[model samples]
Target: MADLASLQSGPLRDLPYRVAWRARGVHAGAHRGTSSGAGGLFRDLATLLEAPDPRRLDLRASLRDPFEQLYVRRFERSTAITIYALIDVSASMGFVGNMRKLEVAAAICAALSFSARRIGDRFGVIGCDREIVPELHLPAARARAGAVVAALRTFRPTRRGAGGLVDAAAQIAGRRKLVLLISDFQIAADELAAVFEALAAHDTVPIQLIDSAEAASLPRFGLLPLADLETGRRRLVVLRPSLHAAWQRERAEHEALLASLAARYARPPFRIVDRLDWDRLAAHLMEARG
Candidate 1:
């Protein structure tokens, strides 16, 4: 498990974070944007009729033209992206394997916040339990890494309900943002559907944190006591080979459904087990941009 103290110790932490969706903000930053702006990266070249900026004129190309048609360079805008770590601090996220899921969530939040700051983007964190935790909702700002880590350290997954995600989504409704929703996603499909609809306005990345044993490879010979992590309900059942097979099949079906839902929103879900894999996440973001 990554210690919080160590996680926040680096102020210069960087990640190759690329915005997968088009950014709408006008402020200059490091991510690609749809609107063209001054001092932006090269996008393409266009004919004089399309782009009339004399300052961007390609003199060599104009000289080489047989028809003497002028050409101009075009550049894409790089703008600031607001990155919100909408973390699920419900009881389900407290499950432990090598480390608690909540710890993994904290690590992810810390890393993301630090990386966002490194790139001059605004970073914020929202802790969602029974509802969006009022004290844990930090509005996006630059250079708040220390405060964000402190807020993360105060989170405890003690909530027993499953309807907080919709509330969390509503908090970010009016603005375009890059939201990283860290959760186990144990809620009912109907509830999740509602949350998905509420988050349709932003570029949402669902980070599904799972315990290793819960995801796969359970022992099939013993009596296992299974408990609803959120509802405080428990049951004891003999884990026979046939029952184990059925469990595996059910898990596969659920994952398939999640993939389908993410595809519908044009955001593929990323999964991490027992620990937050920062490299994997950074690589996923890089590939997403392409």
Candidate 2:
């Protein structure tokens, strides 16, 4: 398990994240906002007819053009981004093989909220299962990383359906906020697909939480009885060498399909719950910034 204190205090304490998509916030911060302002990051050159901002006219560009058409500079205004940590507190997340997935989720949430605070971004947390957990919904605020961590610590995985993701995503405002979605994706592809569609308006960062045992080799010879965490259905089956190999292949294919779908919105980052590494997550955040 990751040390919560380490996340709150260390070299990674004030880790910064790069926003992949432009934010639509009105407050002044780090991310690029949709609304243009007097002073911001220079975007590119544009014709005066297109921009209509005479004050931004580039005198040199206008002189270079033979036709002498006026050129204006376009800038992207910096705005404070609202970072939301949407965590899945379903029964599957409680899988305690080598480490509890719920603990991993909470740790990640702590790190993200602290990082957001360091960058002057508003931080929020939404814990959901079959339904949204009202008590766990923390509205976006600055310097509330400790409160977010405390709320996540109280969360316990319960047996809940996976139909609330779309509804939960809808609860977020359509202001192009940054959503750090952490989940052990045990739901069906069709259901998860709806969630992606609902959250298309925001910049979602998918952190697929996986138990180490899930990716490891299974017993080649055993009569294992597996029970569905959500449905509570039990099935006993003999695990042969062939069966184990087939399961591995199927899991790989499913992961590949998920990666393809997730890439359309944000780069997917996989975190093994048993051996959570902050450095690996930092690298992913850096890549995401690009």
Candidate 3:
């Protein structure tokens, strides 16, 4: 895992994102909004009486009117939206493999913060374990990336569960937001489902952190020592060919379940293995239809 200084020095790329729904915020920004305003994508022509903006009068439309009613062009306004990184900071996130899960998560938040600010959008972070970590809470604002990076540097995943995600969902109830739900997703199926249900109103993107060393790159036969990060239980087992295959199968099943659940209420889960690939992440964000 890279230290804070190294992480800061790394180049942060702008993450391209899009939303299927129209934004409702009044602030001028990049995303398409429901409001009709002075400059944006042309929506439709309305009678001058309805739009009341003579400056946008359409001469051709007015000439074609039977009643000779004046017409004005209406455009869809671009409005600002809040982007949040809803991170799962459970004990399992502390696991170190080919790459540190928590470190990758922090890098993601920092990139998002930078991207959002660059595009005139508000960015925030909400970290959860057994409960919401107050120190990791950042309200939606056009804040600097340094602030986000600094805050994440202090976060330590010591708690056990991610139940606080549901609570954090409730806190961001009012407006539709772009939520990047980052986690290894080592949680009960029912709990994960519930969290998705709570955040259904928002455009949620589930980013599943993965480390191949955890299961994929295991030796075919060896004495394997494993410890449950959440439960603090240690076990030693003989890793046979059959057991290895079974382990991979179980992991695949779990991923399948998560994908099915995400498809129901959000976009398909984006898997980040080993480390964060900026270009791949940008492509996913751009192409994801949520």
> Which candidate number would show the highest lDDT if scored against the true structure?
3
Question: Which has the higher TM-score value, candidate number 1 or candidate number 3?
Answer: 3
Worst 10 residues of 3 by lDDT: 1-10
**Per-residue accuracy of model 1 over 182-234 as CA lDDT, tens digit each:** 77887667776777777778777888887776666789899888887788789
Candidate numbers sorted by lDDT from highest down:
3, 1, 2
lDDT of 1: 0.75
Off-target runs (Cα >4 Å) in candidate 2 are 1-12, 43-76, 233-236
| Per-model CA lDDT versus the true structure | 0.75, 0.75, 0.85
State the lDDT at 153 in candidate 2: 72
Which ranges in model 1 have alpha carbons more than 4 Å from their true place? 1-12, 42-74, 215-222, 238-246
In angstroms, give how far residue 111 of model 2 lies from its true place.
2.2
lDDT of 2 at 144: 57
Which residue pairs clash within candidate 2? none
Tens-digit lDDT string for candidate 2 (1-290): 43434533544344457777677767788877777777888888889998999988899999999998999998888888888888887778766666666666677777777777777788888887888877777778886566656666766777666666677788885777777778887767787777777787777788887777755667899998887777767899999999998988878877876787687756675555566677777777766542
What TM-score does model 2 achieve against the real structure? 0.80
State the lDDT at 61 in candidate 3. 98
Q: What is the overall TM-score of model 3 with all chains considered together?
A: 0.91
Taking all chains together, the TM-score of candidate 1 against the true structure is 0.80
When sorted by TM-score, best at the front, the candidate numbers are 3, 1, 2
- Regions more than 4 Å wrong, model 3: 1-6, 217-223, 238-246, 288-290
